[model samples]
Target: MTRCRLCGSAALVSVVDLGATPPCESFLAADQLDEPEPAYPLHLRVCTDCWLAQIPPLITPEETFTQYAYFSSYSTSWVEHARTFVADAVQRVGLGPDAFVVEVASNDGYLLKHVVDRGIRCLGIEPSVNVGAAARDAGVPTLTAFLDPATGSDVRAEHGPADLVVANNVYAHIPDVVGFTRGLRALVADDGWVSIEVQHLLTLIEENQYDTIYHEHFQYYTVASATRALAAGGLALVDVELLPTHGGSIRLWARPAEAAGEPSRGVADVLAREKAAGLQELSGYTEFSARVAKVRRDLLRFLIEVAERGETVVGYGAPGKGNTLLNHCGIRPDLLPYTVDRNPYKHGRFTPGTRIPILPPEQIAADRPDYVLVLPWNLRAELVEQLSFVHDWGGRLVFPIPELSIVEVAS
Candidate 1:
């Protein structure tokens, strides 16, 4: 993009360009395989003035999220993560029976269900009608709409201001960073807390998580840049927590400027780490593109070698990040055959650009594949446990990110 989406500066710097790919989650049905699928340039740029790493808004959330393919409840570990977060948040934020919690982008009520169990009134504001319907079916009150400034104010007006606003893994999804942040402010009480979890730019660069860069994720954030973005909406960041979910992420604790005091030591500590990594400038990012290229090269070489041996390599998850890797590496079904996923929405569908068939997880065990590439490598521990049955057939699991590694599983 010519100017920063957040800062309106023209000093955007290149990070890594993964050429072009279709919208990550746009799985095509078997009938549409013969039709043409569109692709867009997937380039990430960091605004020099604001230091916010972003991709041009080539695709909007409405295109991808309206009939979303992903359901958070499908992941056993992620559900537990949400349960733990709810329990911890109740204690940390002092949420009680009378308290009100609101979750933006609440998928299938995975997290808010915990709030309901505790008798704390909560509402989920979600854009996808299907998933939002699922949330309501689970007895979690939900509004089917995207979170913007006006929607937030209307929610506040109707349901009253929230005591704790939880927006996990969604801060990067919106192109209008300022408007989204302001929506967050409008949903929360003047003294209420706003908790946001996003993939930290620090870990994304350091860990070689380039696949996380897709059209839907408008920007990446370091603590320093996120703090500036929060200020635009009059929300003051007060504390920060490093999280292990989604490769690596940061949970930002914020409040209205009137109530927010000095930021916690963790904020300064993270900013220091970001600065030390040279993210504030262009030096830390210079080697990323080359490293990303290495990942693509190494993975292709391994897949090719496996194919030459007549060994089968199938994918384990149809995650969006997996599509980025699949498209970037130019891997087709020949290199890696049909993949499997626990999400039923992807079943019988094909991945966007690569056109690999998506099957049920049971297909892997049924076929007894030699190796199953775990696309959602961030869930290594949990997936290893779930796929341990692969050991019964002498099958191994492959993780393609942060370098390619094959692991043996024991039953």
Candidate 2:
């Protein structure tokens, strides 16, 4: 009996099976082309007791994040997002030179750069060796290790309790959610706040974002589910905000249980809305499998039709989400000639399961195709604007999920 990672619930139901797939970000070098890739069953299950959505257990953080290649600084939009977040957080939290800010999973110090510029003391806890080294190179003091209860205590001992702890897009990736939250409680100051950003599970189901399911993402969280989980670890949700980044996400502000602050209206409203929408009910997830099946069929049909017409089609963003979507749809180089990535580590490599080569964004300009499939559809607007130059050839952009749509760029 596989127990739910969040609430220790044994009543779990298998929702959707994405078949065997390689790790989403495990791009292969050209020389390592013949090396056999290990694939695992990409099965999704929902905890009937707590309503937590998760993938079947397989990989650990040590197996996944060590020697990771992803760098947050690669994306111009992400960098801008971090800058804006730091500015807003400083204003809201009244952080100053005396306050110490800690960031968990601070990839390449993309967000902490803004914090450090203000003369405020900051520390970053990152597990990936390559990305952690990059953060250190950027002059951000980062500890290259996972944030657990023991590490958190060590950080508090060395730097004192943190006044602010920022965890952006790391909440969903943690396998031991409760342990991580406990670690946050131990590291944060009495009046400190911890802000976490995660892809909202409600939005994932409603928006047909099944592509985000990968082994690395252990849980898909809702505000209600998250509140319950946090409360169990002596944390309370103080504020919540819906963010447009990462398809649809929620930024949760939490503090120690002793902090006497009223919960934000957004938190209550979202919880009520989720309850009204039956997110807390078991039937909500029971119906999701059929919706996912339709998406797979529609995406495959569109791609097949485009190929049948002899039209060239390529993908954008060699992200983990893209790998899951492509592999689930059984897309290969024969269908998608190649993919473009901004990250240098992935640029010359091939996507794990599909074996589609990843090249620089310049490839899209040099070899103009009839259609560009935007894989990271959540960043469609940003990507479309960035690749608007594709319009010179009268090419159209295609988005697979939430239905297929082709739009001509305004040149």
**Per-residue lDDT of model 2, residues 246-310, tens digit only:** 88899999999999378988888999978877888776777778888887888888888989998
lDDT of 2 at 283: 67
Residue range 1-411, candidate 1, lDDT tens digits: 699988899998888989999999999998999998899999998988989999999888889889899899999989999999999998998988899999999989999999999999999999999999999999999999999999999999999999999999899999888999999999999989999999999999999999998878889999999999999999999999999999999999999999999999989898899999999889989999999999999999999999999898899999999999999999898887899999888999999999999999999878999998999999999999999999998999999889889999989
Candidate 1 weakest ten by summed lDDT:
210-219
Q: Cα miss at 177, model 1 (Å)? A: 0.8
> For each candidate, what TM-score against the reference?
0.99, 0.97
On the 0 to 100 scale, the lDDT of residue 201 in model 2 is: 88
Q: Which stretches of candidate 2 lie over 4 Å from their true place?
A: none
